[model samples]
Target chain A: MKSPLSLEPLFHVGPAGITEPVVVSWAVIALLGLGSTLATRRLSVIPSKGQTLLELVVSTVDSQIRETMQADPAPFRALIGSIFLFTLVSNWSSLIPGIEPATAHIETDAAMALIVFVATIAWGVRTRGLRGYLATYAEPTWVMIPLNIVEQFTRTFSLIVRLFGNVMSGVFIIGIILTLAGLLVPIPLMALDLLTGAVQAYIFAVLATVFIGAAVGERHKPVAPSEKEP
Target chain B: MRIDWWTLGLQTINVLILVAILARFLFRPVIAIMDERRAAAAKMLGDAEAERAKAIAAREAAEAESGKIAASRDAVLREAAEAASAEREAALATAREEADQVRASAETEMRWARAAEESAASDRSARLAIDVARKLVARLPDSARVDGFIDGLARALASLPEASRDGFGAGERARLIAPRPLTAAELQAAHDAFARALGRPVDFAVVVEPAVIAGLEIETPHAVVRNSFRQDLKRIVEELTRHDGVHR
Candidate 1:
């Protein structure tokens, strides 16, 4: 079995090597795309079971984004919902034989985290203007500017590390247990790994929502002495 | 751990593509359909509310109409009752008037019948009395009946007015009527008695009149004196009829 930490190249396109995680990510994308298209094709006011399930998923995502950001979910729904579905599907893809979960690779997790980081800044700039977005680092006092700026990057890094570590460690531990013990003995560990995969996907999506919400959320201004007294 | 930049790039592109596809096919359409259903439900509710209001208004109008009909019906009933009462009263009055007229007519008829019956009864009693007197006088001697009528005639002639006595002496023929022929002595006696009672000379003739029943009547040119059972019976009949009328 391949090491969970290393990504084996499946193909090469000139200077860039196409890896297993990247190929699996394409499959996940295609599956999600086809499912969304089919689910939405015959939508009506009166919904079927499949349409109901799809709508539930979409509304759940929208409510989460709305609650976290304290803003309209229209602008952020597509990106946040896609992140949640892709991570969830990718984490569970390990159930298929000869298919490793794309989220187990640091590269895929980092890419998703980088996307979230970039989107947060973009949304912050859109909501608060570029100068106001930059002003968030200097909040409370000017001395906290450096630490606040570093905290942004570190928080994004933590998002990537948290998802990658949880998913990759679960895969690695399950592999080690399957190697040492009989196949039936590792069934409990595999079940636990599935639970861990689901939890990790949820955590990754929740963190992304928080990071984006922080960017688009209204800044709390310090109340004056007179206002506080009231 | 080795970082693969190409895989990172590919995964980011895949995620972006997934976002685009999912948003286009799922989020936009689902939200739109939900909004449409909500709007449709609201419209249906509004229509139902409007229909309810219309139904209420129609019911109110119907109730008002029913009230009006009831009021009109009551008025008609009252009028009909009053008319019926008036008609009944008028009918009663007419019936009473007819009853009064019938009663008056019946009373008049009874009075006329009573008068006729009394007159008939009195006439029958007088005729019976006259017949009895005539039969009794006929049973007596003819001379006695003649002598009795002659004395009554003499008394009646003496009570005559002076003008009637003077008219008898003016040379008009005078006659004496009797139920039967008189004897010569009886006629001479009647003439001498009449002359003495009249206080002048009077020419008298003897005549038979069966209609005079059993009586003697002295006839002069201007006066006739009757002293007979028939005259006495007529007087009695008149008296009895008057008495019967008074009693009634």
Candidate 2:
């Protein structure tokens, strides 16, 4: 079996090498772009069946974002919606023969986690201002500042490891089983892998939502009956 | 697992591109459409509410106008009834007045007709009485009539005042009238009778007249004596005519 870690370069664009995962991601992007354009080409007050479906998806994402962040979904709709759709599409890409899901790679997962990390900071700064956002690390006590600062990078690292580990393990197990037992014997494992891929994508999205919520949410405070306004 | 910097950069770029595409083509347009539909629905609801209010107001106005019309109609009907009643009463009063006038005129006409009838009857009676008396006296003997009238004339002359008797004696002439021509004997007898009643001599000329109605009439310068059926009949007719006028 080939090493799951090593990417086979399909082409070169100057010093940069275009790999299999990169090619597959471009295909996913193209499919998503084309679908979006087609679905939204003619919008109406009275929705078509296709438009109903597209709206349902968008609204579901919007609701999920609102629920998780406990804030308005307007500013974060595109970012969160894009993340969920990309992750879901990448995880499900294994259904296509000869296509390796981009989420199964360490590089792709790292990039996604890095995006979440940066987006959280940006949103936090926008909501609380740079000084207030920085001040959040010193919450509860000034002594917890160092630990709170470490927690940001650690959580981002955990997101990458979690998505990459789950997708890569599913791919590896399916491959090993298919090699040992015939292709038909590995069908159940492949189905299980599909489930695992879906779960991993969902977990990644949920965690990203949590991180972004923490960044943009109102500063945590203890509830006291005496402190409540009339 | 191996990390590839190029793959990482490529994936990041793809995700950004996807987000941009989805935001532009999908999220923005879909959200805009939803907002527009919501706004349209609200506008339609507001317009429906306004129309309902206008309809209610119009219905109320129509009802008010109908009420006013009904009231006016009733008032007009009342006035018409009053006018009709007044006109009926006036018509009845006029009819009664006309009936009374007709009754009064009929009574007056009856009274006038009765008076005229009575006057005619009285005139006829008077004429018949005079004619009957004239016919009776015409059947008398001339001598007997002359003698009877001479006797009445002598009595009337005796009743005269002494001065009037003296004046008769002094008169130039005296007239004597009878309803028929008098005989020579009747003339002489009349002169003697007058002279004896007067107790002096009286110049006498006898005049014969049929209009005396078989009676005698003597005239002197100061007095006259009438004892004629003609005179009696004239007085009786005048009295009857006067009595009829007074009764009427």
Judge the docking of candidate 2 as incorrect, acceptable, medium or high. medium
| Tens-digit per-residue lDDT, B216-242, candidate 1 | 987665666888766777777778878
With a 3 Å backbone cut-off (N, CA, C), the pairs that clash in candidate 1 are none
> Best candidate, TM-score-wise?
1
**Which stretches in model 1 have alpha-carbon errors above 4 Å?**
A1-3, A66-72, A128-151, A210-215, A218-230, B68-248
lDDT (tens digit, per residue) of candidate 2 on B190-243: 878888898875676678788787779988666788888877888898998888
lDDT of 2 by residue, A32-123 (tens): 98888888899899899998898898888878877777667788889888888888888888877678899889888888888899999998
Give lDDT tens digits, candidate 1, residues A141-176. 889999999999999999999998888887777778
Worst window of 10 by summed lDDT in candidate 2 chain B? B163-172
How does model 1 score by TM-score?
Answer: 0.73
- Give the lDDT of residue A56 in candidate 1: 91
Q: Chain A only: TM-score of every candidate?
A: 0.91, 0.90
